[model samples]
Target: MVNRVEVFAAIRRDARVEGMSIRALAEKHGVHRRTVRQALEGAEPPPRKTPVRMSPRLAPFKSAIDEMLTCDLDAPRKQRHTARRVHVRLIEEHAATNLSYSTVRDYVRVRRAQIDLAAGRRNEVMVPQEHAPAAEAEVDFGEVYVILAGVKTKCRMFTFRLSYSGKAIHRVYATEGQEAFLEGHIDAFNEIGGIPTRHIRYDNLTSAVSKVVVARGHDPARDRVENSRWLLFRSHYGFDAFYCQPGIAGAHEKGGVEGEVGRFRRTHLVPMPVVDSLDELNEKIREWDLADERRRINDRIRTVADDFAQERQLLAPVPVEGFEPGLILTPRVDRSSLITVRMARYSVPARFIHRRVRVSLRASEVVVFDPDKSGRTQIARHPRVVTKGGQCVDLDHYLEVLKGKPGALPGSTALAQARASGVFTAAHEAFWANARRRLGDADGTRELIDVLLLHRHLPAAAVEAGLTAAISVGATSADVVALEARLHLAKTDAIAVVEHAGAVGGAGSGRHLVAQRHLDEQQDVARDVVAEARRRKVVSLTERLLLDPAAVIAGLPPDTRPLPSVEKYDQLLRLRTGTDNHPAPPTEQARPARPALSVEETP
Candidate 1:
């Protein structure tokens, strides 16, 4: 009730300035004898500390309100009691009507803060955290925009960071789907040469989580369930996983990768790179990644690459088999040699039409295979297009059907694509014009189809070169085109032999002899093919095997017949020597015994 400063000042004035005696000051100040003695001895009086006052009316109520507030720590914020609720409960539960509502309200406010402090609800201050080398890492997806194929498109960068070394791996994807998520992990691990730690941290992404069922007041680990595919992937890589709290609360948990994605994007992907395809964009990204090895992170003397080099030994060795981050689908090939996957059409071989085939769909490519074969035969393959309703056609798949319907060759989609792809080159166009002059349109297109079919077994560039050579030599027949194509191809296909400083006398002589022999054989085959073409004789491919050795060899049946048994020779030896010493061997199947006759009886 009294100000300590003012009281001290009064003691000083009365004792020093007014010249009051100790007894007089005590009476004037209405103070104790000791207080007056202290005031007279010193210029100022020392203030006393007030004792903590206990409230009699609210003593019992304090415990009750504290009990309620303690549970409120875990209870929903909106469901917790207000001051009015506490006051009403006090009167009803403890018969505390004598206590005023304002007294309880004011007391409850201060008490709540004290209880919260006791319950670990104080304001936080962050301290530097140290990570164990190769013991932990973080994973996250960051969104970035770049000009892809001249179109500004949104993309996601899947980033993985080793917390201790500050080394990170990043891969860009069109979507952050589960396949991309798992594939990124595989690729990142491979780039690092091993898997970092056993535990990887994530931010409750749907790719890894099936559902986050619990909101508040529940443990995060118990509330969320891991996706089955994701679990299998983790098991395959032999790694444990941890999830961060939802939203911004968990941002600090995986802060390493969080900062890495932004830093990498700003440093490398800033100028909005324009690339024709994802492969091109990835190639640029790869170059930047390799070049980034020279830069250091923060004040560290060692570069990121240097730290990664040290950390590589601490990481777990990769598994024997790598995981295929792809979705398997069984799609039926359509009549047009096309199969629709994710609403996009990809062409397969026409022979597989109406048959179900297996498709391996990755982030940027689709590979189709014949299901009956154990992945030995790949029917068709195409780069995946991000946009729906896109179609990728391979002209070779339609060659056989085009051969029968040569009239459809001009207006067909396959022809247009072939022309654009340079598969149907200028040489082919020139040859076609010449063929049309010699033969009619129907016959000319058939010859073109024959040249196109050569592409199936040989490279298109070699075929185009052969067409150029054939056109130069004034050869209009398809057999001449085939012969010229083979000649150009043998030289192109020959393996390059590098000459060392000290070489043998004839290192490449064998290769030169092989090429000359191939040329002579091709010339003979060409003469036979031309003779067959010039005449009107209708010959099936099987009948003309004498012309093409490769077709003949391929058409030959397997030599599955059994060889004569050694028992027959044994019997001949016994009969010639007239010695019955060796016993006849038992046979697997029953046969009738032949009647014996003397050699001279018939004569």
Candidate 2:
């Protein structure tokens, strides 16, 4: 059962050590005399020759098959004949009815390559690469599935990996379009704190490639037409893009990232990630990226982080001005207070209904802008709706209109969505119910709407706390709720200010005492201000004018008339009081009287 090499070794050892004759070796090893002689001549056995089988049935068609293969040389790579096609053609054209398909297929396979070789067409070869630190990087999108909001959803993982360090930044996006593509680069650049100096390797993704302009015979990368937005993005970041050739031929060009995407997916995203949103999934990916810094790739000597530290400094500094990676659209707000972006509807302020609003559709969110004399102002922001016909509504946007139609508040879609999202909390519901019981449905709903409006000027937590406080005190008035919210906000601000002052005022030595004293004085001033604000009466415009007419007039223009004085009437008051013996004499006599005309005389 010994192998040939072992047999040869044994034969050589026995022949040399025992000095046995050829006939004796033959007798001992059970081989013929000539075989023994050959073994004695050389310890190593000669390689066994492979017999070339002559196919009688296929020999007649060999010339035809060669001609077909030769003609295939000029044909498009994909349009060339397969082994099966060659077999079929031989039977059909030459009437080689008895030819086995396997014989014709095998002959065609070897003969085709021989023809191609003679014609100077060769298979592609991959060269091993040694990457320089911070010189180059690769970007790619890997498809992954995640349980998003309890639904199995497909997402794209955008990966940007440094060639040398293998430090990667990953982001999950709902779409792999141009906006997400650009945004991925921005996020990676910001995370790495710089850009790769040479170029980033990428496949001709549609996001970056307008078209592959080359014919099949030409080099795809050289003849590609770059996308305008992609060109602008590359110019802004000051990096070059080295697109891989189209299809499988180009896949090996960015092998680093191609392998990296699979590796990361297997390592981190193996168990399909469960997340409420893409943002959450991306957050987890970022954490995984940080953890990956300690890992080594292949036979690397240092950790990913160690190599990245050295490479980081060599990278080009990122530009100061940030790029907006969102797609801008001007959508007319529909009558339902919604604006449609990419087939999904998102609610804007009710006032924006029937008006054209500018929307910035980003990877994770939709932001609507309202333009005025003061410039563009952000009116609403909602998490992007991924599916068509989906809607994202904000209760606050409809609160103003709902105030007028209080009954609608009970069954409005916006309110339901608000409740589902925990924006309308238990405290809010409690306050609303209490208000309804105390004030009846219409007035109570109006009060709830007013409380909701408080969110515009106050923090949500403060407003919620205010609602809870008001409910505890059996107060259904929106004013009382607003007052309570302000109180909560003031408390929070005071605590924050005091903590900030303490932080700014350092510790150690007599200087600390001085800082503490200054802080105390600041606290005293703040308390006095708060007390003054609390004690001051809240008044309407009319009451303020009656109480302090001078103050109001002082704010008026210089050309404005002065307010009339009541001092002239004080003389009459003095006579009535008997404090002054002023003349009450010039009554009707002193006053000039006008003559009366009788219109009835003419009639």
Candidate 3:
């Protein structure tokens, strides 16, 4: 700016004092024609003018805008008005028709700082503290956006992060409820192998806090109290709770987990993770947790997993079996053998219809229980589904209904769901088709029902294998399929028992191998109960034969070879000497009694 001013002044002096023409000055001073004419005509480039303009349209609304901005100083930061919001208020409240958004924006931008200054604006300060090893942790919930089944969806993620090691656990949930909250903590404890000995910090989440009183002082204990269920959950796990203030103002209190949620979602869920089910998504979450073992913090010298290794040694061990955070609902099964939950249908057993049954709804599974004359039995369990109006059906649940209406079996929702889940295999379809051709529709459907009932007693894989074998051999009867199924179960079960026993001890003993052969010979419970007795009898008889081999040989038929007669020769010498033939036999030590064998026979 100074150089430009000096050059303009020099051009004017040369043009005026040297008596140079305007055209000559333009060429001599390297100035534009108009610049030389203006310089020659003006006095030292008349001081730059300051212009002032007035907007009559916005004059009436200025006071109202100032009032709104002043009121915003006392309101929550997030609730503060933007320039556009102020413009909208001006039009709606003040009837200011001619005011544009830009006019309000310019004024608000210029005057808002004065409003904040009058309200004493200050930046929040945070104190940094060193985290003790295995002494504390932070817990919080955050929203996570994911691509589920090609559809973009949002879910809540419960994050638990250790303060010392920066280790974290992330779990995605369809809903953020008390059960999911408690379950996340329990799972984190179980994963890390121990509970933090000191306090666990939490945001003032409704899941943990029932109310937050404003009268109490800085002590969180007096200001906020835990909900009844939350207190019970904390007591069961044997941990202390630390509550942050009830809003975004105290977010820094548990910022470790708050930041963890964002960090993990950005690192693992970027480029959008597409998964078919929540379980598959959680499996990927576990993989991310394992992968974090190799990651180091920004200024750390070692991996987070290594830091956790040190903190883990100081952690308090949790009990082997502990609390189960799940909701116990008593929802009656409808006529369709399905129960409505969260606006979706989940199948239970047909026998439970119209009857109130106990349903244990956990984070992942919906387990149903039915009461009978004997006791309560777990009838069925299905993965909890979140899709609205979606149905989760089991073929076994409708097998009894299918038997009465074979035509319905062909087009039942249960069968379709089973096929989609891959529980109803191609082998089942093949067997059903073949049976239909051989025995007609009704009888074939009944046969399929019988095969389905076998699943209650035998493993599904065994039953499927049996169906494949039966179809291959051209055996169409349900009895043939059942027999093959039982044979497979017996064979596989025997092998399992042998392998389990060998694993319990050493494999070189060969005792398990011998027992496996004996087990394969019979599958009846009564035979198994007497198998040990039979083994003892054979051993006892062999011992007696060895004790009196000469006498047993003398009693044998002539075709068999006889033992040596050493005892007879000793008897002949006694007879010649005429000594007491009944003299006491030379005393000898009795063989040590063998230890009793232990057997746990199946009833």
Candidate 4:
């Protein structure tokens, strides 16, 4: 193997303004040909190792710590004790050490038994026995790269693994926001078929934690807890929650889910899982988690799924319907009577503009439930915007209000921009007409109305400029029209040419053209006849045929009556025949004719 130093040295020696063969350099330096070539190609040499020394202050405790760690090779990792804890113990009890904590920790870590504990592995192991009733589940978030909707979207998967059964539930979401966090819990509980007995465990995530206590001389107990607020919400669904210390490294009580979260990400979400959509991807993740629950453990009698099944009965029953998780906020409507929720704007009636509205937001949608308690009416609904740190407002809602106020049009920047951009079609003119009717003489209404035109162009920007110019010069609509004509004349020239060529001869050049002109003149008469026939056909087929069959039958007595003698039948059939043979015996002749009724003559 060629060392980096040798390869780099060879390239430098050969580079002295005179090139040398990389292969020859490799032979001379005793480095691999590829290494020499890479060096010559401007690759940096590998970094040199720097020697680090143990902190001398803690040298004395190193050996003792190492021995203790090795002695407890089979003990649980939490029981083995870290060097920092050991050093603290030494100072507190033995009163013995000039030793620094770092030196002792490094020595013990290196010399400790390499025994692989099941708990230490990233993979989760099944609990050896059935969990006690009411044991809480620990929840956490893990990040994994997944392909969603054809883009490599970074998604955070929420993991909730039971402390007793080792059963893990997972869901992937676009964010780790509060909605995702709370919704994940609800879904996981539903999958487990019950809520945990007493409380659910969680790290000091912002969703649950309001404060972190770091008092000296005392173990941190996540205090200032807002359990009431959470419980107020959760109480509706039924679940108790407990939080772990903010930054503790203890694993005896809280490490189960930490390892499980990592295991799920690596085993199920890594190396690129492709899905058609986020929902599909989440469904795949859920299936994988459920499948994981079915695997048997080496030391456990039942699988994770089986253990969870046993614990299900002990869990609290969920509410009749689950509580929807969301962030609640209040926002005031703007002068436009529009409230901006989740970046997309929605509007109340103009009467309510500037009034405060309550918004109930969810993961996928923003529901503007009726603010007044009169009834269960929804003011508006908009798709939830998930893009971080931005506001999304639906401009269409305000457009509806603007439709009622035509006078507000001129000042509407949106409408002005639209007009300049050529977005105003004939439909926009009709909308403008309607708006003007609704909002006569109201300047504010006009301004709002102009906003509708912001995205349209009818009068091109140049035309608008010309109109504005005319208006500035105190020109009326007639004056503006005259100015437009003058501008059009000034920018364009009329062309004239004399045509002496006689008409050409073709299939339709002479007679066909005259005939076409005649046909066009008679089009109205032809159209009325065709329309009447179509109307009659529709009535006969759909309504009259159904409502009064006898009336239709009376109108067409010949069609409904039994066939007359062969002579009459042949005459009617002749109308359908195309100058060929008489219409063949009605295919019904294949069956015997009904027996002639016995003569009841005179009776």
In candidate 3, the residue pairs with backbone N, CA or C atoms under 3 Å apart (3 or more residues apart, or in different chains) clash, namely none
TM-score, candidate number 2? 0.80
Each model's lDDT comes to 0.79, 0.85, 0.79, 0.62
Colliding pairs, model 1 = none
Model 1 per-residue lDDT tens digits across residues 306-350: 877888899998898878787889989878888998889988888
TM-score (C-alpha) between model 4 and the true structure: 0.45
- Candidate maximizing TM-score: 2
- What's the C-alpha lDDT at position 285 in model 2? 84
The deviation in Å at residue 54 for candidate 3 is: 14
Each prediction's TM-score versus the true structure: 0.63, 0.80, 0.68, 0.45
Q: State the lDDT of candidate 4 residue by residue for 239-313, as single tens digits.
A: 777777555543445677888877777787668998855678777877798789888645878888788777777
Best-first order by lDDT: 2, 3, 1, 4
Estimate the overall C-alpha local distance difference test score of candidate 4. 0.62
Top candidate, metric lDDT: 2
In angstroms, how far off is 181's CA in candidate 1? 1.9
- lDDT tens digits, residue span 190-276, model 2: 999999999999998899888888777876576778888788889998999888878787888889899999999999888998888
